[model samples]
Target: MKNNIGNQSDYDERQIAARGQAFQLAYFALLGALLLYACSEGLFGRWCDAGAAAGLCACPSVTVFAVTCIWRDAYRRPNERPAGMIALMGFLAVVNLALGIVRICEGDVVQEGILTFFICNTAVGVMAAVILAAYLLRLLVLRKEREEE
Candidate 1:
């Protein structure tokens, strides 16, 4: 019990927990937005793609599960969480970040004459990217702590 929470330069559980809580809140909020979008505009626009909706629903749910595992201090245990799930979440986070960059730079997020809020996919993507990144970093720190232990 001699201050084994990892190096002082690195973050402790409180920091990780705070970040996880933020991610959980953001994902839940995103879930709500997705629900509204699916109900109102239909997944992938007004075409009402049930297949897409079902597939997309898994993102938030799985992310929540992965983030919760990190939040609950499961990194130290052997059978607490699947490595594949964590890896999948990491891949998604990196992809989301890249896609957000592409959308903002190459994609014509601005319309012909006006900028609108509802059409701002790039912004939302970037926000989600940030959240996902924090989760990944927190996981990395925890894993490192486990290694040190």
Candidate 2:
């Protein structure tokens, strides 16, 4: 893509790279937000209410990351793998949401139990796995496209 201003011609490689970097940075930020919410509410509060609240906070990050990826890639390329990764992430987010609801409904007594603690920890594990898998999928797809070019 080329931009012209009077007699000057400019290449927009930096702009495209900046957009890609911004999208990746946003993804990283969303991941950090998810971790912070989990730690602050789930671990610190020791109540189902905390988990519910944290889950509410996390939902937006998932949505934002998915939409940002879609928008960033819209004009450039047609990559089905990123869409698949987003779909998987969306599925995992729904599972996490359901687990959060279950935790919230179980009351404070359940939250205090070792089994409940382990279950919540397991939910976190699932989230971590989803995040890692999505990141890897995105990296692999982008690398393959670059190689093709």
Candidate 3:
């Protein structure tokens, strides 16, 4: 039988290089965020629950990776259209934000002077929104460049 795995060689050299750099940067960002989280917790005390802490550590690296890929024009496959992805990100942002707001209104986002797991919904929403915004901004800049050229 033929190999069932993907070709894995579809990405061109530039895309591969860009992705490598993005991964490196994202890794550094994740390390820094985790270090900060640990230091903050050790110094000031627990400011957020585990879920929120995880979001705090994860969001920055994800954003860095996505933004880097977007700027490098490597966020999508060469044949892919971004409209569907844009719509999906928008939907995720809206849903998470709505849920987060509901949780806040219900007084479920914080307890005993520390943020609870419910706050992670807001963090996830914010991260998605930020990535969406970056992607849109990159698209706009590319459009402008194309128009000028």
Candidate topping lDDT: 3
Q: Rate the local accuracy (lDDT) of all candidates.
A: 0.54, 0.53, 0.89
lDDT of 2: 0.53
Q: How close is every model to the real structure, measured as TM-score?
A: 0.36, 0.34, 0.89
Per-residue C-alpha lDDT of model 1 across residues 51-133, encoded as one tens digit per residue: 44443454455545545645665433433454565576456556655665665576443444333332234333443454456
Q: Global lDDT for candidate 1?
A: 0.54
Rank ordering of all candidates by TM-score, starting from the highest: 3, 1, 2
Give the per-residue lDDT of model 2 (tens digit) for 1-149: 55642221322454356566656765776678767766866666644455544544454455445445434543223323445665666676677656656665665325443224324433553564556464656667768999999
Summed backbone clashes in each candidate are 0, 0, 0
RMSD of 2: 11.2
Q: What residue pairs are clashing in model 1?
A: none
TM-score preference between candidates 1 and 3, better one = 3
**Where is model 1 more than 4 Å wrong at Cα?**
1-34, 42-45, 79-135, 139-149
Where is model 2 more than 4 Å wrong at Cα?
1-19, 23-65, 74-83, 108-149
